[model samples]
Target: MSTLSLRGIVRQFGPLRVIHGIDLDIAQGEFVVFVGPSGCGKSTLLRIIAGLDQPNGGQITIDGRDVTGTRAAERGLAMVFQSYALYPHMTVRQNLAFGLENQRMAKEEVARRVAEAARMLQIEHLLARKPGQLSGGQRQRVAIGRTVTREPGIFLFDEPLSNLDAELRVQMRVELTALHKRLQATMIYVTHDQTEAMTMADRIVVLRAGRIEQQGSPLELYNRPANKFVAGFIGSPRMNFLDGQAVGGRSVAFEGLPNLDIPAARETTEGEAVTLGVRPEHLAFTDGAGLPGTVDIVEQMGGESYIYVTLANEARLTVRRPGQTQLHAGEPVRVAIDGAAHLFGRGDDEHAITPRRLP
Candidate 1:
């Protein structure tokens, strides 16, 4: 296992800077995930860590040793790419042993490592098959097995499961999580999929346009996003935002709903613009007066349902219900914002204004 650190990590493509002074510390045996939208520099940062790309500035440290100038091969790290990158002609066993052989390791030692990796990955039976002869999931296992054979201090994965179908991706996610637990190796993963970050990471770093937006545990980011961007990016179906005006002190009046008093840390002047954020699950259906809307769509997902409604002011909101609902399209519905509502100041820099409440 290894502890990795990055200080003032900067990357530039000619005149255009992509990574701007990133600073992070990853503990030994920690599974940290970098997540963001496309062109957010998550993959670029991963490449810098893997020594595949050098940073324009800043230092990379591994196990308390500076390795910014070290070659990738000397970094004692293994990376699995989105593409399997396995040699089509080479069998799984050969692929797993190729690196060791190139390093001129003893034949017995190389064989022992290959055997152990194959066994750990449950790909022993497929060791004799070439990449073309195996399924996508099987090929992925071989690729991971190849990395495992190296027994590196850290493992890096760059959207390794993006090539698989949804079901296979989920299966591989569980497999990778179990592998991490079994090996207790430091792993850093990069992906645009928030689900992957939420499910697998001990800590998640959310990047945006070459800058760190937020870095925290999944629930921390979900329940208490620092700003509107992090709040909108971290959750599935995303948090709903509605325009409102601060009536006074802790009272805010929604555009099409009654005024409600929420816990706000800062005092707001009367008639100040603010955005109200409420997750789908945080909005409850109420029989009495509330935010009036017309149900536009309903998505039934086995045990739960999502009610999509258009409010009087044309703002759309999705309400997540625990069970199947009889609510249908064109039906009138009223939703009351629970105490879990988040309040953010409206502007270019939309920071959260609501006090953090216990979940």
Candidate 2:
């Protein structure tokens, strides 16, 4: 395991600067994930770390040693890519042994490492199977096994499960988590999927337009986003946003509705243009405690249902409820917002706002 640090990292393609100056400190054995929309320079940043691409300006240090000008081969890192780059003709064991062979490792040592990796991955029975004979999940596992045999100081995964089906992705996520526990190596994962970042990362680095938008734990970004973008990006079914003006400290005058008091103090003064944010699960159905809305759609998912309701102001809202609950489209309902609502100033900076309680 090793510590990885980047200071003033910058990447430019022609006149277009893709990655702006970024700084990060990754502790040894920490599992950090970089997540953002496509074209956000996440992949570019990872490539810079692996020495696959040199940064325009920055210092990269691994284990306290500067490796900014180092070659990828000399970086002492194992990378598992999205496309399982396993040789189709080679069996699982041969594929795992190939890297060690290139370094002129003893045949016995190579075999030992391959055997150990196979056992760890529970693919011992597939040793003789070629890539063509394995399923997508199996191929991905072989790719990971190849990395395991290298036993590098760090492991880098670039959306390794994006090619798999939903079920396989979930299964592979569990396996990857277990693998991390067993190896305890520093890992940096890159993905656009928020769920993957939320579930797997010790800390998530949310990027936008080649810049770091936010960096924190999943819950932190979800519950207290730094801006409207972070708040909307980190959650499933996303938080609802409504245009409003700050009525008082932590309270906003929601359009067509009474003054909604937020639970926290507003950083800005009254009458500032702001957007109110409330998560779907925070909404409760009440007789008259909530803003009135008519259901537009309801999606049932075994254990829970997502009710899509359009409010009087024409803003769409989704409310999550137990699966047994019945809410139909075209039905008028009052959905109450909790004291946990978030507010974002017009400048897009996240502002602290207090949520008001109902009578």
Candidate 3:
């Protein structure tokens, strides 16, 4: 079993504390992603797990064995870095065999592992190529193959695709997902890209400042965010938020927006300040009704379009529409928000008031 666990993990650099007490349990063979904005300690936490960095206070365990004080190599974890970290002078074959060779692995066993990893990553044809001769994607595959040759208990990837272009990033994301399935290895990946976290992870741990804000399956985080920050951060184009106050016990009133009835599951007292969140896809154009606005900008993608609308109160919102849109900048439009709105209490500790629901 390759299960991993962390307890009371904490890290500090002089007077600055970057990672606060964090506890997590990762099941064997699960592909987990740590996601957050830069400086949020996601990478720090992953480093701690890999034993590259020590936590000021905490315990790390793998398969129920304590490894907090073990050296990085002793912990039996393999890490793929963001920079690929390949030797400039070595060919792909040499790079993959380098680590195993250091351990004095049997020649036959090393050859077998190298051949299997090369085939698995589809890099057999490029084995003789040097890093300078390979493209970004090929070098990345070689980096990953280096880790595979070791067959470590846990695989740690620190933003492995950050160097690739948009199209290659998407392609690598799919390939990584397939690799996880084929190897069935316990994997932990760290990245600031939500799209990567959403598309590749079996579960995502969202971090902020020095603590974990939330952790769950991608759909769970998207459909039922735990707070205002999470609601704003998880989606593409992001969820739109508006200032409002509860009124008549079951309704909310916003400037320039019609009073909206709250769902019974989301109980709110009258006169309480609240923030209302609606995703762009949830806002639909309606004629002769709903909130009044003028299109500020219209962004057209191949399959969908996003209309940026400015309301009377000067509040801007993005409305997503299917396929091509006939809307244009400065055009008058009215948008009706779907009932699947999210409500959160006021201030920094804006806890969610919206009932958790599946999409």
Runs in model 3 lying further than 4 Å from the true structure: 264-266, 356-359
Q: Residues 190-273, candidate 3: write the lDDT tens digits.
A: 999999999999999999997989899999998888888878878898999988899977777888678766662247877889
lDDT string, candidate 1, 28-99, tens digits = 999999999999999999999999999999999999999997999999999998998999889899999999
| lDDT digits (tens) for residues 1-359 of candidate 2 | 98999999999999999999999999999999999999999999999999999999999999999999899989899999899899988998899999999989999999999999999998999999999999999999999999999999999999999999999999999889888988898999999999999999999999999999999988888877888888888889888888888766657787887677665435657788888888888787889667888999888898988999898888788887766568788999998874367777777455434333333
Task: Count steric clashes of candidate 1.
Answer: 0
For candidate 3, the 10 contiguous residues with the lowest summed lDDT are 350-359
Against the unseen true structure, what C-alpha lDDT does each candidate score?
0.90, 0.87, 0.90
TM-score of each: 0.96, 0.95, 0.96
Runs in model 2 with CA error above 4 Å?
A: 348-359
lDDT score of model 3? 0.90
| For every candidate, C-alpha RMSD to the true structure in Å | 1.5, 2.0, 1.6
Error of 2 at 256 (Å): 2.6
How many pairs of residues collide in each model?
0, 9, 0
